[model samples]
Target: MSGAMRMLAGLYRPVESQTPYGGRSVTFEAMGSAWLACGARRRSERGEGDEHHAVETMSAETRDDPRLETGRVLRFGGADWGIVTVRPLRPGRVGLELERRR
Candidate 1:
């Protein structure tokens, strides 16, 4: 972690559980928190006609953590961001692609 990576983002992993009526439910469990160096947020609009949606994409870098993977959720900046992609930038450095729909 570097001085620039000042934001603390909480990592969450998805957990699948069974319901009382033989149904399945997916929930997120807190894994831990990590220091993230977040980049600028990019916004895009989609859809046609009277309906349109905005999708926000952001990139973040953090130390290598085996628990982090695709589909995990990151809680930061008073919002929950979905982990779109994860890649290794270099030794001990992991890059994450995060997305949030608004």
Candidate 2:
């Protein structure tokens, strides 16, 4: 697989959300990182379809030593979104939050 794909896939973590039935619910995974912008293409179009510029940087390391990055996307989700912080929780776990634009 491509380097970026491998990186993205490696970020997947098993997720088990709370259920009202007091039983295990859907078995899925959560993305270790959001605001992904490594592969975004730049454009000069001024219309609504024009792409915005993005910037990112290495954030922290997982318990398994896998590196993570904070991606920043300008003008996304109807606002400027950025991975502002990353905190290591434990081996193979991390907490990430977005930095609100002012």
Candidate 3:
């Protein structure tokens, strides 16, 4: 909530509904936007036999919002980031661990 906030990330909530065929469907509904101070990008690599997997993650700080929860979708920088974890940072701020979605 200060000048250090550089990114305006849009938050989305998952909405689940029951289908007529007794199936379930999930969709994202736009919650709102929040200013976040994104930290440095981190990358990790994993290998499983002959397969290799790369994951990109980053930390960000933003004002505490009740709708901001894990499994939510965040859209910014022309990409979608999945909320991996959320923790309270201070009285009104929360720390977020985001993973870049493929």
Best-fitting candidate, scored by TM-score? 1
Q: Model 1 reaches what TM-score against the true structure?
A: 0.81
- Candidate with top lDDT is 1
For all candidates in order, the CA lDDT equals 0.90, 0.40, 0.87
lDDT pick, better of 1 and 2 = 1
Cα error, candidate 2, residue 60 (Å): 14
lDDT order of candidates, best first?
1, 3, 2
Candidate 1 wrong stretches, greater than 4 Å: 1-5, 17-24, 47-51
Cα lDDT of model 1 by residue, 1-102, tens digit: 244435898999989999999999999899999888988889999879999999999988999999889999999989999999999999999999999989
lDDT of model 1, residue 60 = 88
- Stretches of candidate 2 exceeding 4 Å from the true structure: 1-67, 71-80
**lDDT per residue, candidate 2, 50-97, as tens digits?**
654443323322233333445532233344334556667666666444
The predictions' CA RMSDs to the true structure, in order, are 2.9, 13.5, 3.2
Which lDDT tens digits does candidate 3 get at residues 1-102? 344447999999888999999999999899999888988778887768998777789889988988888999899999888899999988999999999733
